[model samples]
Target: MREWHADYLDACNRHDLDAIRSFLSPSVRRAHLPSGSDAWIDDLAELFTAFPDWRWRRVQLIAEEDRLAVHLRAGGTHAAAFRGIAPTRRHVNVAEFAMYRVMDRRIAEYSGTGDHIELLAQLHGGLPT
Candidate 1:
């Protein structure tokens, strides 16, 4: 399961929704950030649609009983439209973190965070202050 976390990242990097979906349990529930802003991830296709070039790199994962905490640097060039914004063609890197709870060899829950302020700044062609 520890390696599967890495596999997920690789699949995400490739923007392969099918591969990413292969990792989900039927009961899979993923959260973008822990504050409960979103109820659930309906499908993997939408996940990749939102993050066209999402790549998780410099990953440090800790695997423990029933859970895995993954720390990563997520980045990509914005080549595709997202969130109603035109493509920025911008290379944005952000320090992102996530924790996954796996049950029965499939991810059951996930929570995550990142420097949104910095990402926005980069997207606007401004360096983070």
Candidate 2:
């Protein structure tokens, strides 16, 4: 699981959509991505566009049977619009948490959350007064 997940992260870091897709099941269930793997991939593409240098590093990982949990730290520079916020050219680092269920050596299901509030705050010059 560790090696597989590391390779998955490497694909993401490389922005290789095809490589990332190879790690997912055909019917993958992504809790945060309602439209399925395609949507999730599209979202990742959008993020890469917004943060051209985006990168994620695993901070923690736990594996049990067919399940795996991960904590990641993501950092990047804001180079384009994101969630309607114009580019601020700010650098942001945020935490992300995810849990995955692997089936047949591929990710069958997963759910995750990120520190979006902190990201927005950083992009917006430390939130509203």
Candidate 3:
């Protein structure tokens, strides 16, 4: 289970498109979207590109049945544009949570939330988005 969690974060931090693609199940769904995007793999890849140095830390995992809920804090220096904001070089930390449904011990769908508001606040100096 830890190995699975580590691989996901490693792919995220490295922004490795191949790793992301190879790891995803064809039916991957992201429940965070109102219309549950089926393009989770691509969306994840884009997010990492937008925040190239983005990294996850202090991860916690809970397992039940064929699913896992992951909690982690992500932080990085804002060296690139994100959420329509230009570079701020601001160090920001945000909480992240994801629930993954596994099929045959392979990830099938993921629902996630990230605190982008705090990152925007840090960049905009008191502005919250």
* Top TM-score hit: 2
Question: Model 2: runs farther than 4 Å from truth?
Answer: 127-129
Q: In candidate 1, what are the lDDT values of residues 79-107, reduced to their tens digit?
A: 76555557777777788777888877666
Model 2 pairs in collision: none
- Candidate 2, residues 1-129: lDDT per residue as tens digits? 999899999999999999998888878887756646787787788889999999999999999999999999998999999989999888888888999999988888988884267778878888431
* TM-score of every candidate: 0.73, 0.90, 0.78
- Which lDDT values do the candidates have, in the order given? 0.65, 0.86, 0.69
Q: Per-residue error at 15 for model 3, in Å?
A: 2.0
Measured on C-alpha atoms, candidate 3 has an lDDT of 0.69
Which rank order by lDDT, best down to worst? Answer: 2, 3, 1
Report RMSD (Å) for each prediction in the order shown: 4.0, 2.4, 3.1
Q: What is the Cα-based lDDT of residue 111 in candidate 1?
A: 71
lDDT (10s digit) by residue, model 3, range 3-111: 7767867876787766766666766666654223236655555556556777888468998877888988887777766778888777777777888887765667777
Model 3 TM? 0.78
Model 3, position 113, has a per-residue lDDT of: 76
What is the overall TM-score of model 2 with all chains considered together?
A: 0.90
What are the clashing pairs of model 1?
A: none
